[model samples]
Target: MSKVQAPELKKYMDKLLFVNLQGHRKVSGYLRGFDIFLNLVLDEAREEGTADKVECGTVVIRGNSVTSMELLAAR
Candidate 1:
């Protein structure tokens, strides 16, 4: 299936990203891929909440749930 992500977002492919989702969930992952719907395919993904950080490997996130996204600087 061919999913097209925004041209702007394409720049961040294969880089670390900080993604904010609905319900106050924050995700940090390496952007492996994305689609037209803004759905994201992340590697070594980690989600953070008020309580703690949860590790999620090779995750595909639905576009509709994404609230905001930023490319994180590499250290």
Candidate 2:
């Protein structure tokens, strides 16, 4: 879904999410953990770019630092 509410997040746990962060960085990963404030921990995260992506094992992102997040359709 393009718009994600708090409740929707929980239902989509362990699913893929595209996360936009500050400084024009974007990532997609399995949604491992999150909090009420939107702080997130992503597993098997991949940094998006024009070239080959850099594999990020795991990432913890602060709630305030996140710009947006989109739930990706399951494969």
Candidate 3:
């Protein structure tokens, strides 16, 4: 029998992410990991029925600053 290996996940490990904390100063940080963090944040908001209050944007993080901001337009 032959064995198959799944494709390795690419390193977006250091990519910067800017999260606007709802009018609070924007936060810039190394996105070492995010999927789990995002889910947790969302889940908590859902339980409190406050998820609708959150707004999110994706920004390319460079060092400790945001490099660009763009809304995802439909194709």
Candidate 4:
């Protein structure tokens, strides 16, 4: 599998992103910032489940918990 580098992630700044976390949790938000460790700061974040979406405002996601991330179309 291809790896995502820091520079590559830069392009997605301020864009919407869908992130899959461990334990099947999912979240989506606009990319705000990230660190070398891949820890992410999301603006207007929300936790999404099968039946509901919970508003999270701004959140900081630990890099280790992230399983995958995908860019999403503008809302």
lDDT of 1 by residue, 32-54 (tens): 88877888998999997788989
Better of 2 and 4 by TM-score: 4
Clash number by candidate, in order: 4, 0, 0, 0
Model 2, span 1-75: residue lDDT tens: 575556347876898889999989999899888887788989889999878898998999888889999988564
Report the number of the highest-TM-score candidate: 4
Can you write out model 3's per-residue Cα lDDT over 1-75, one digit (the tens) per residue? Answer: 976543231243444433444333444333444332232111111111233333343333222332332222211
Error of 2 at 3 (Å): 23
Ordered list by TM-score, greatest first = 4, 1, 2, 3
49 Cα displacement, candidate 3 (Å):
28
TM-score, predicted candidate 1 vs. hidden true structure: 0.82
Q: Each candidate's TM vs. the true structure? A: 0.82, 0.81, 0.29, 0.87
Which residues of candidate 3, in runs, are more than 4 Å off?
A: 1-11, 36-75
Q: CA lDDT, every prediction?
A: 0.86, 0.85, 0.31, 0.92
Candidate 4, poorest ten consecutive residues by summed lDDT:
2-11
lDDT of 4 by residue, 1-75 (tens): 987566357888999999999999999999999987789999999999999999999999999999999999665
Clashing pairs in 3: none
> Which whole-number lDDT from 0 to 100 does residue 70 have in model 4?
94
